[model samples]
Target: MPERTETSPAHHGHQRSPGREQLETATTVFALLADPTRLHLLWLLAGGEADVTELASESEAARPAVSQHLAKLRLAGLVQARKDGRRMVYSLRDGHLRRLVTEALSHADHQVTGAPWHA
Candidate 1:
């Protein structure tokens, strides 16, 4: 078996530790996620891609507010947008982000519901 190192994931796995640049980038991603509206937008996108109108309607955040939040997320590279006819559809840029948003919400659910944490 491979010996665990400081860089390993969960302190006992094989994943490498994030370097300084990666840490800064992750910090920026976390900062963007700090906003409730932005997080909601991301959570919605985790389900699948959607255009602005659909997102605004589902989130009930207003068309303009959703657009602004999407702009920030797009600029941060957490999400991507593409023109679908006349509408701009958005989606999580990668599976990693989708999983991250899903896991974050799952963690929040545990805290709010007083559920036991899983290993």
Candidate 2:
């Protein structure tokens, strides 16, 4: 066992490039996520794959709205869908994206509810 730190100094050596391309791309993804409904959908998908009906029921949004959000998320490369027989099951496309959404919502919860933040 060893002492733990929030971040290791060696990790900073792998920082992403400062090129505008990454910034612009991230901005586009954030723009797509601006809607609450879409963000909720992403949160659900981050947990695991689910069909539109489950998402709608859990999120309390209309089925059509959930479908539309899933479509947009799929198009934005944030999520993926596959036909499980007649049903289309959806999930996050990248593992990094799952953590990104989870971390963001956790941070928001802390801010909205005045909970203590943890790294």
Candidate 3:
């Protein structure tokens, strides 16, 4: 068996199995993502970092709702926020999450629009 490196993919290329903690954490992430409003917020952040105003405006969801959603996502470590003067700027925590949100929405688009799935 090849030695696992920091960048190695889990499972298929090795024998490393997901532990209970990993499984539980992933389930929690999915649970957080189950809400359509939250999913939309994540999808927006995937584009680029933005403040609450921009997110609320673009999402067409109320500003308070956007703030609450961002708070939940931030607590989950899915998204991060930084103070930009008086406004709070928010963005995905890492490339993995960015790709996850993008791919999930893309899959939904395919399902809704009857687009053919790619391999």
Winning candidate number (TM-score)? 1
Residues 7-78, model 3: lDDT tens digits: 566633435677899889989999999998899899988899999999999999999999999999999999
Candidate 3, superposed: residue stretches over 4 Å from native: 1-15
> Which 10 successive residues of model 3 have the least lDDT summed?
6-15
Q: TM per model?
A: 0.88, 0.85, 0.86
Clashing pairs in 2: none
Candidate 1 lDDT, 1-119, residue by residue in tens? 47865754547432676689989998999899899888999999999999989999988889999999999999889999999889999999988788778889999999999999985
Please write out the lDDT profile of model 2 over residues 1-119, one tens digit for every residue: 34435574325343544479877988988898789999899898888999999999999999999998888888888888999999999989987778778888988999999999776
lDDT value for model 1:
0.88
Off by over 4 Å in 2: 1-14
lDDT of 1 at 100: 79
* Candidate lDDT values, in order: 0.88, 0.85, 0.89
Instruction: Between candidates 2 and 3, name the one with more favorable lDDT.
Output: 3
What is every candidate's alpha-carbon RMSD to the true fold? 3.4, 4.9, 4.2
* Candidate 1 ranges beyond 4 A from true positions: 1-14
